[model samples]
Target: MTEVLTKRKTLLEARDLHVQFASRGRKARAVDGVNLAVGEGEIVALVGESGCGKTTLARTLLGLERPTSGQVLYGGAGLDYGSRALKAYRREVQLVLQDPTGSLNPRHTVYEAVAEGPRIHGLANEEEIVRDALSRAGLRPPERFFLRYPHELSGGQRQRVVIAGALALAPRLLVADEPVASLDASVRGEILALLLRLREELGLSALVVTHDLGLAWNIADRVAVMYLGRIVESGPVEQVLTAPRHPYTQALLSVLPESPEPVVLTGEPPDPTRVPGGCRFHPRCQVLGVGRAAEVGVDGKCKGEPLAVLPAVPEPQVACHYAAATGS
Candidate 1:
């Protein structure tokens, strides 16, 4: 199926973003030349293993971290972090951290926690805003939870409270980082449902950052696979998840518990400071040697030209030379 990329109006965009940091005298490229977009009312999953730069990209998108070399566009305009516009933009977008325990204040009551945003911004009707936010986040009868503290709530409740805090500001877009990783498996469904419910009820968009492909399958409208600081594959969730084009993406999905044939690799992904030349994934591609290198289209060029994301019609965009040749 040819998946059209622009099925909705874009809400946020990252263009050739590069966010690097100095580590041990070498540059650690956490996010390298990544171009991504989240459309209005769309739930997009940004998936990758740890240290693949997904978190960094999320932070950059939220303006929590500055990109070293690219522009982060919010609603189609580049954000100038110094201006008043950036602050206003932030109020429109909010972040849900991975760990509820770490994000929620140990001392603050649910009311205080949810009320902080509006109070800080000097918005009107703090009490009403807090109740509405909590209710929207699925803490039914928000008054019942207003006096409770983080410890007084269940794992799921605490997550909902964290979510409520974000929703309090009436954000149009949410950047949820590992939103369910800290919750119990049973409660994970509840939180995921809440996210979907918020989108449906409030006309909100979301960028859900997680390594779980199943979660993406469950809720996201689209999926983007990140590897070594760049997007290797992205398209409609059903298309990219079922028919991954990049070799790295194919290897990732092959190991899914449901996959009939699972393919494994020999080594770990290379270090960020010492990434492989040409294609970052070339060193670990299993089929590179299985088929004659020439026949498989793996050659010196594959090991030399750093792969950039290729624009493909109908999405399912890829960055691997062998993707077209091997049908991966």
Candidate 2:
């Protein structure tokens, strides 16, 4: 457990979570044996490429998708899937999607969009709630946006509106999926700052689902790197990002603009439906491909023995046979 998590209450947790989708005769394992947690008022980033199951894990945590096995827990209690229980759960954990333009209905005004959640939950003082949420989301003088449409706002403002909608319910956590992916670079910074500000001001906890390592470095207290339905490495942002042990994580960081030399893995990640055996990342691992595994006498294990699922803890952990054996 990181110092942050140890000091605060665990707001959400996933234990050995698995999500599978069956189509035709094959089952796609979207999330496989994952264990993760979010501390109260902490921000954790789920980092991975597309098809790596980060999004699926986020959906499962939000109660949008039921796990094939394992559990999603809130405040140490297993989630109840009953309608009333789920509805009540959602009020405390809200989702902010990638595209603000698509997230908001064109016909709905800003007030309606922000007020929608409080109204549905039958919360009193709808106007006050909406206005406060909008202001907190950085749309100063919230009344100015009440009658505006999505088309009328800048990209950043539109995203703020989407965030405001989530805020209206007084959610304790926000699961923002690629929250700044669609915005301009400058706008992206603004949105990231808004999230930090919200956390500082409201003690908000967030699970930010994104592929951008830079964004994780900017905002997350911890980061979990996922690949082919599993977390290959995870720990405090500084430890994982600065001294990454897993080859997959090293490759990701190497590609950053500040990296001296980029490490490029060959080919795309394997299909989730037919994940490679042993180390799922071995097929594209730079260390394995360069004979480091063989030099360490772990080549056979890398191809035949699967690593155990990584436990979400404070210290950095990497689930690579070569890394574990060689202490890389």
Candidate 3:
């Protein structure tokens, strides 16, 4: 297989990534032959269904789970987990998990949790480190929240504390996995705003893993749509969301709970273990038959064979074979 070279200065790059697990005496590809890149100081959102590889990909990016076969390059250099580069990479790339409550230690106070990273890395004085992290996370009057434990704070406060911990290391890239999922509806907006503010203030890049299209629409600069361990489509947010090209992508956007009731796709998503032949989504796709194919001018791409590799597109290349059909 030929490698696709990207000219953009990628802060983090995953090439032909494959993450698999042993189950029932066979390897299950949780993340299969994936390719992804995050540009310097850019926010790229990874969106997909529940069983898709979003979480697994995020974990792989952080080096928490080693891919069976692949290369993770940090700053154009390959990630060597056993070397000093790995340690430095960890400091540069931090993760903010989905469950804020579970992520923080109940025994440790907010100050302790936030200061843990700097202490481990021996990066700063404890007092200044805690204070600075709390301040950066918008947990003003840092002293007020210092002694508070996870149970002592509200949902929003707990999430803020977690964010503070991730920021303590002053990471270049932050992988936020459903950061707002556990928060109250009212607080969701506030958290999103806080993230945007931090991005501007710290000049940090982010990879937000979310299943909610609306949230991605509101926050992400570019969106990467994942399906069954592969990126089915990816492009600028407006182009992908407003006029989605991939059949699966279009079906996904149509089901979003927007006002006026978007197009409801018939049938359900394919089973993960028993993916259909050709396009994994073809079984559930509504864009079948001659007329619809001609409408998009991508009839052959979708019908011929399951695309083993992502086809090239003009803007921010999409993985889909029928990307041009969507008129994006």
Question: Which candidate comes out best when scored by lDDT?
Answer: 2
Worst 10 residues of 2 by lDDT: 1-10
lDDT by residue for model 1 over 156-195, one digit each (tens)? 9999999999999999999999999988899999999999
Q: Which stretches of candidate 3 lie over 4 Å from their true place?
A: 1-8, 259-272, 289-291, 294-304, 311-328
Off by over 4 Å in 1: 1-5, 292-294, 311-314, 326-328
- What tens digits encode model 2's per-residue C-alpha lDDT throughout 84-116? 999999999999999999999999999999999
lDDT score of model 2? 0.93
Give the candidates in order of TM-score, highest first.
Answer: 2, 1, 3
Error of 2 at 102 (Å): 0.6
Clashing pairs in 3: none
**TM-scores vs. true structure, each candidate:** 0.94, 0.98, 0.89
Candidate 2 residue pairs that clash:
1-314, 2-314
Q: For model 1, how big is the CA root-mean-square deviation? A: 1.9
Q: Which scores greater on TM-score, model 2 or model 3?
A: 2
Report the C-alpha lDDT of model 3 over 196-310, residue by residue, as the tens digit.
Answer: 8888888788999999888899887778899888888877787778877777787678776663545555566544455556666654556654257657666556655677755
